[model samples]
Target: MIRQRITATTDPAAVHPGLAEHQSDMIRRCPYLGPSVDRGLTVWSAYDAEPGDQPGLFALLVETAEELRTARRESGPLACRNIAILDPEDSESARKIMQWPAWLARNLYAPVQLMVGRFWTGVELDDSKGRAMMPPPVSFFSLRNAIPSKDGLFLSEKLPEIMAILEQGPGDDGRDVFAEPLGRRVDDPASVYRELKGLFPPPSLATAG
Candidate 1:
């Protein structure tokens, strides 16, 4: 079984940014285009930060949360941003994350997969497809690739592949996505994972199937 706990709330401004405060905004909040069905944008931090009054990166996550109001309105495809924090314990990942800013500073065409990774959110299936299908909410996946549309974020090595899967429907999503988990199971920070519940995509093909 997985262990989970929520230590209470803290002010957003004071929580440590975790990343060096040099590049980009340490904290960010985008207005909800419309009503939220409970879960809005989920920002995940690795084991290093816990969401509680003690003060850590999660305080910034809490501040990012917005009040869910109003009924849903029909809208076009969403283009939300994904900013995932790496587990400080993984030295390799940590080094890469730290180097990302410097890499971009010199050459805007920096490879994004080397540093930042976004968790799987889920597939969007309209009414005919049976609403939206998702995995157990307590999932934080590692997505490798660059966000082509943003700034100098040209589509790097892994993104075009990822985009193909994203654009394709489930049955046609390709065999790569159906493969088993890439690495050993890493238990996500249960408390925060729970907080962002019901918002993750299926982890494997079996579940997605």
Candidate 2:
């Protein structure tokens, strides 16, 4: 099971800029239903952050969903700005960098859909498709690459291939399949692999074959 560690409940006026004045009252009156469905945004600590310096990064995974009809209809990368929360030049800075097109799309055109990666959420999905969709945790080292778009990000990679498979209907069939437990953020990949092996002992040769 997965558990949420944080919640946002501030007035729309105080946080979200898109909420209109008329909607503010309605949003306020509406019960605080909690963060928007735990869309895979989480606090991630760097492998070597010092004590008390936990949660070194704020990660938001964009995942393909059935509800993303407009995104599904599109053939290429959906444009969006990579909002760097920190300085862009610094290696450790959290600044999100959006290429000219993505910046323009977010600032000039309508907002596009982004998908969330389920592996990082620490919640296991019950079905094979959902499980197959999980990517190697190391892949997140390039967080921006997971963002699928045709527009091309300034310095980010788009994930159209990953998205296409995930978007398939439940009854759909294909050669695409994968099986691996979600991995943890650690100092090295070898250590993580070792830990996973212990949790999931290798199947016998007959079973594996």
Candidate 3:
């Protein structure tokens, strides 16, 4: 768990070097999370912010990407995963969290995948693209009131699972099982983001109707 602790940060740059430059395009692609993701692409109090789970989540994924980067260096090529973690529909507070997949891609430049019933576990660590990549399993460890600051999002209980996955790396025997009852696979976060924006629409627009 040292990785999780030490890696934890409220900074966007800490996760990836390209964060700032691509942030605008990312926001444009996933405008639903535009304001939240556009917190200037700098460090901030992600843990304490309301709906506050953004930064911490960023940190974890940042570390995960680092691990994959390392694996790629050591092992020839790497596949990336692009997964989305949809918040429970009833949860207005957690709703925006769903856009995180797009934000992560903009920053990490990796694909994300989701394993249904697994909360939001999605990934794409594969060699299909002939590049070093990892399965995009977006595991969403549920936190009933997990609003980032609530600290519920970072419960110790789920650390082991995350750590285990980190240790397993990509293309493991246990992956298929872990990915049981798969949900959606988001190849194009931008298009998906636009589609979602239309399907869900803004609260302001919904009310006007």
Index of the highest-TM-score prediction: 1
lDDT of each: 0.24, 0.24, 0.30
**TM-score, per-candidate, Cα-based:** 0.27, 0.23, 0.26
Worst 10 residues of 2 by lDDT: 136-145
Q: Name the regions of candidate 3 deviating beyond 4 angstroms.
A: 1-50, 78-95, 108-209
- Model 3 per-residue lDDT at 11: 44
CA displacement after TM-score superposition, residue 158 of candidate 1 (Å): 3.7
Looking at model 1, the pairs that clash are 137-198
Supply the global lDDT for candidate 3: 0.30
**What does candidate 3's lDDT look like per residue over 29-59, in tens digits?**
4333254433322122111122444544444
Candidate 2 lDDT (Cα, 0 to 1): 0.24
RMSD per model, one decimal: 16.0, 17.1, 18.0
What TM value does model 3 have?
0.26
Q: What TM-score does candidate 1 get on C-alpha atoms?
A: 0.27
By TM-score: ranked, best first: 1, 3, 2
